[model samples]
Target: MAHDVQHYNLDQKFDFTAATKKGLFTVLGIGAILLIIGIIMAIFGGGHAEAGAAEGHAFHWYQRLYANLWINNVYYTGIAIIGVFFFAIQYAAQAGWSAAIIRVMLSLGNWLPIAGVLMIVTFFVASHDLFHWTHASLFDKASADYDSIIDGKGAFFYWPMAKGTFPIFFVIRMVLFFGFWVFFFKKFQSLTYNEDLAGGTSSWYTIRSWSAYFLIFFAVSSSVAAWDWVMSIDTHWFSTLFGWYVFSSWFVAGLATMTLLILFLKGQGLLEMVNENHVHDLGKFIFGFTIFWTYLWFSQFLLIYYANIPEESVYFLERLSSDIYGPFIFVNLAMNFVLPFLLLMTRDSKRHGVFLKLVCLMIIAGHWVDFFLMVQPGTLGHNGGVGFMEVGMFLVYGAAFTFVVLSGLAKGKLVPKNHPMLEESYNHHI
Candidate 1:
């Protein structure tokens, strides 16, 4: 079907019709209401002092909000960063089949800088609730709140009081991570746009060269970013594979997101260049990464479980101990690993657009739960519960992300007309 189209003449611009704008706003508005309601539940949800609360050992309502906010922020950041990673890899490989869909990845990559800003703001706003090391008393030996474990790792995450700085190391690392991603994304985006105009190998060469450089930077920064943002939440617990683990989850989610978007466009009669061959490749990614994510998940779990180390085991222990999170721990594994592994294993399933989209959505939601388990157990302990706030925040971020990515897609040509591989991509087949 795709071979019949000698050239893609579809409107490259996204039409933000009144209905579309209304839909986006409605989602955002509904999210806001849900967020407010979630906050109320968090603040006053546990009616009368329960077992933990009655004992004066309960986590406060604000803590739950802080935890939820931080986790969602991290989840979105991973989604955005994965876009840059995807683009960088394709450029590095000089792969041609993706030239047409490259815009979707680039548009997705555009969200990183914005995600960076939101992450920084969230850290500051929820510092007390999220990181114990952020508190001055945690480092003060004389203070009752002093924690030796936090102090031990203070050189990296904690700033000295004499410097009168907050998150100096943390903030610097955050800035560097996002700065690296945003800088390379814009450079590559410009090269692609320029290639659309100039139609030469010069822009291509530059993109490929920079892609190699970006990948190296990604290897180090992605892990560190995960360590800084997510791992640090469990300040006392540590994992050697945490960075890779987070990266796997991020990569799969990114592929799933891009896949969903492509399907949506195809349904609307756009992306005539995109065929089942393209969808199949995407399914392979979602399938392969789902396993990779599971491997890391189990590897991390197995190593910790077998070693039986108190510090490391405590992370899972808290999650399992929680009435709310206990079941989700299995649910997280099932959605991310079990379901994707089973559903996407077949060749026909990968070729089926509808089935692949359903699996993609499930994997995306599963990872959210995976991330929620990673976060809530460490931060909220047994105090947390699924409610309006969690659902609403998901909508809020989803709406915001959709708006930004679509706006980006609208700004550029839907097809990379001048790309050297445009023909190859249009005729791609498995």
Candidate 2:
């Protein structure tokens, strides 16, 4: 069958209009207001008194604030890195269908440098409040608060230093991972921008090579990152599937972000070369990975539940049986798995803008809840729920993320004009 190849303006750049900026700023202002209100309520509402009593310790309102910070930190950071990771996957697999939307994927990396700074700074500021192992007494044998399990794992965070002192090794790993990620992002950005001007396949070959290396590094780094950032929050509990579980959640959320952006651009009459076929493939990824994420979640939950090990089962017991978080557990599943699975199952749903948009938004918010469940139970005990604070922080992070990604998108050629497989993407039918 002969296909009509549509020609596109190779030099087209995204117009980062003042109107769009205004809209984003409006969202930012609203988010800021909500955040302030949530803070005031936390201070005056007496919500933490119950939580403190339940946990046998004084739970400060600031701890809940810090937990929210960490939750959005890890959640949005995952979304950002997934962008770069997905871009690399395209080149490594030599996939042609995504060529037209490749730049959209790369734009998410623009948040990485900022995210790295936030992750490090938040860790320093909120370490004691959010991370259990950061308490020096936990590592001190003479202290009543000493933890044998955490002490045994001390080298992972404090090697070359006393277990109770500072987490030199952990900090180093954090720095090195972000350093490498930023380095690679800059490299990819330079090469792709150069490709636009030079118009040759040399950059393509180089990118494929670099993509292979990035994938290799990301495979190891992403897993370790999950263990460090999220799994460690439940200091006493560990899951073999936690890394993949976290990765799958991030992957689906990233896919949703990408789809939403693609749809928004289409509404703006940009990326004319990207058609329903491209959207369908993206939908398939969301659909497939939603199931993948569910599989990982169930595997982790079932194993712990079946083993009935006090150490492992306690993790779920804390959330599942609690009045504060039990409802959210079902909400998380419905939004992340059940809803996306059913909503996106149809071919028409995958191809249509309205359905895709709805599901993408749900997946994005749903995964945030997933992260909320993971972080809050461990850090806030029964203190946390999706209150004004949680909603406010998410919106703040969401607006900032959107602004960064869109600003980056506006700076680049919306399409990879010189990409060798551009024609294949134009003719993509499935």
Candidate 3:
């Protein structure tokens, strides 16, 4: 059956209404209240000192706060960059099925600039509390605190300067990655907006060229970033698959987020060109990557578990044996893998809004837990678990991220009106 092009309004723009702003602010306010309550509880709870004493260190409430910040920082940053990544992938692959919804993907990058600042600031503020390698004494050969293992890897974080000084190399990588990501996001944004105005194939070709370059840069930078940001937290434990593991988690979460947004717009009676077919494609990506993430997770875990290399096995021991985090290991697998696998296996489920919505939301929250598992075990030791602070911090960051993405969406055409593949997207079918 031929679809009528006139049935869709290509020029439609998202209206960022007062009601939407109020709703987001409402969530933000609730998150703020919860955050304050969590902080108060941490201050008065008084068990951290005992826990810290057991571990031979002093603990503060603020360390938990910083850990929460770092978790959300890495989690949301991945989602944001994944948006640009998915957008670039569509263009580079010359995919037509997503042309109508491509704008939703790019809108995610709007959060990148904000994420960059939050990540850098969080690193500076929470370095000692969160990253074990950040300790200066670890590099002092004469100090009892020195770790020869960390010292051997010091160049990864502190090259071109003395070890244990400032992590100039690590900081540079952080800034450089975000800088290039934001640069490419803006480049794509400009080209797309210009294409809408000019209505030519030129912009599409140019974007494809740029997308190839961005993907090449991302392939390298994303892995290095996984090492610099998350893997380094467990300074002694390393995995050959850590980078892929992290990227797959991010990719699935990004897919889920994008699917949710598309559903939201569809419910709002926007994106007329988008239909069940487009949604199914999104669902398939989420389902596929969820398994990919699980594969990497298991691959990383199994190798260490079977080898029983004390250094490698210690990483899993920290989580799997802990009363605090042990349950979440299964929870992470169940949510990210089992549920998504079961819920999305049927073709009808992928095409249905309600089913897709439920699974996507779960995937989004599930991946957050995955990151929490990755960071908190290393940073807070037995001190960390999901509580008011973790929940509140997640809500706060989530609300803020929603605001930025929607604000960007409202600023431009929701559909890429002049995209060369617009007609192909209109006729998209499984």
lDDT of 3 by residue, 1-430 (tens): 3357656787899998899899999999989889999999989985455445623688888999999999999999999999999999999999999999898999999999999999999899889888888888889989978899999999999998999999999999999999999999999999999998998799999999999999999999999999988999899889998889989999999999999999999999999889999999898899888888988888888888899999999999989999999999999999999999999999999999998999998998999999999999888887889988888888899999999999999999888888888888899989
Give the winner by lDDT: 3
TM-score of each: 0.93, 0.97, 0.98
Q: Using TM-score as the measure, which candidate wins?
A: 3
- Candidate 3: worst 10 consecutive residues by lDDT? 46-55
After superposing candidate 2 on the true structure, give the runs of residues whose Cα lies further than 4 Å from its correct spot. 1-6, 49-56
10 residues in a row with least lDDT, candidate 1: 47-56
lDDT, residue 191, model 3: 96
How do these models rank on TM-score, best leading? 3, 2, 1
lDDT of 1: 0.82
Give the CA lDDT, 0 to 100, for residue 288 in model 1: 89
lDDT of each: 0.82, 0.90, 0.91
Judging by lDDT, tell me the better candidate of 1 and 3. 3
